[model samples]
Target: GAGVSQSPSNKVTEKGKDVELRCDPISGHTALYWYRQRLGQGLEFLIYFQGNSAPDKSGLPSDRFSAERTGESVSTLTIQRTQQEDSAVYLCASSEWTGRNQPQHFGDGTRLSIL
Candidate 1:
């Protein structure tokens, strides 16, 4: 793949509805990350996945948010009982490795709106 690819470029849902966002990482990349960006705030790291290692879920704001990745391929982020505050652009990124300085490629993101 050329880069990280996120599906459903945009989404709109009711406050209590649930939504799922998908991401496809570049082939061979071993590190994947999920982030959320509010209207005027900086990107907030949501979770991270590294090859065969335990995923990092500390960044998830609440129990309603979760993510899963199989191997080094696709990832899905699920949000339950969505809230207005959860509305934002969900960005997915992938890197060749999981290092502090490794360069990561990002997808265009899924713009989520909660009504």
Candidate 2:
């Protein structure tokens, strides 16, 4: 089965531009999450979606960052008005809902560069 898939392994854009990153979770997984890892920084949880409930967006740095997931499958994170500070590797993960004990499987991530 496909572990996970993220688009544009790398992305480069100018300030004030927008970029959309996509993620595809493994089949039958019931949990999906998005995280960002800046240079030399640890993973920061961005958003999480489970089933069809509202997404948890508390980790979003600003209104410029947003993400959505459909049922327990694909997800997309959109970064609007990109800024140099927003440049980082955006990672997506998914796993079975066996509780916190179940580890998340991550994608290679989308490296965004704001120039």
Candidate 3:
């Protein structure tokens, strides 16, 4: 892909349903990240993947949230038993990390609505 791409853009779901959001990162990028933003809240880091090292999934809110990355390619975030509090923008970003500081290029995001 040319840039980070997120799917659906808008999702409306009843409470307790499951949703899967997808992300396609920029080609050749080695790092991928997922973030969640609620209304008026800052970006909440959900997970990060770099190369073959361990994925950082520490920020996931609960057992209902999980994600996976295939090498340095596509990634998917799944939220099961969604609740009203789950309504937010799910953003994905990719960066080519060299040493320490590499700015991530972000996707617009999947707007999940759990009513």
Candidate 4:
């Protein structure tokens, strides 16, 4: 893909249901990130994956939220036992990551609605 692509632009589910959001980043991009945006707030960092070493998940809200990346291509964000408070737009971004100020490409985001 030429840019980051996210699937299921809108997701609606019961409060306790689980949801899986997917992100396919631009080819060759080594850094991928996930963030959450509530009704009217800034993007909240969730997790970051850089290459094969390990993932930085310090920003994740709770144990119910998790993310994973496959090499440098695709990433998946999973929310377990979703709560009403989890309703928000989940954003995904990718950067080439050669160090020195690289602009990240963003996906439209998945709008999750926990009813």
List TM-scores for all candidates, in order: 0.98, 0.95, 0.95, 0.96
- Measured on C-alpha atoms, candidate 3 has an lDDT of 0.92
Poorest 10 consecutive residues of model 2 by lDDT? 93-102
Give the local distance difference test score of model 4. Answer: 0.93
lDDT of 2 by residue, 1-115 (tens): 5688999899999999989999998898888999999999999999988777788889999999888887787898999999999999999999886379989999999999999
lDDT per residue, candidate 1, 60-93, as tens digits?
A: 9999999999888999999999999999999999
Prediction 1 TM-score vs. true: 0.98
lDDT (Cα, tens digit) per residue for candidate 4, span 36-55: 99998999999998888689
Which of 1 and 3 is ahead in TM-score?
1
Write candidate 3's Cα lDDT for 26-85 as tens digits: 998899999999999999999999988898989999999999999989999999999999
Ordered by TM-score, highest first, the candidates read 1, 4, 3, 2
In candidate 3 the C-alpha lDDT for residue 60 amounts to 93
Regions of candidate 3 where Cα sits further than 4 Å from its true position: none
Worst 10 residues of 1 by lDDT: 1-10
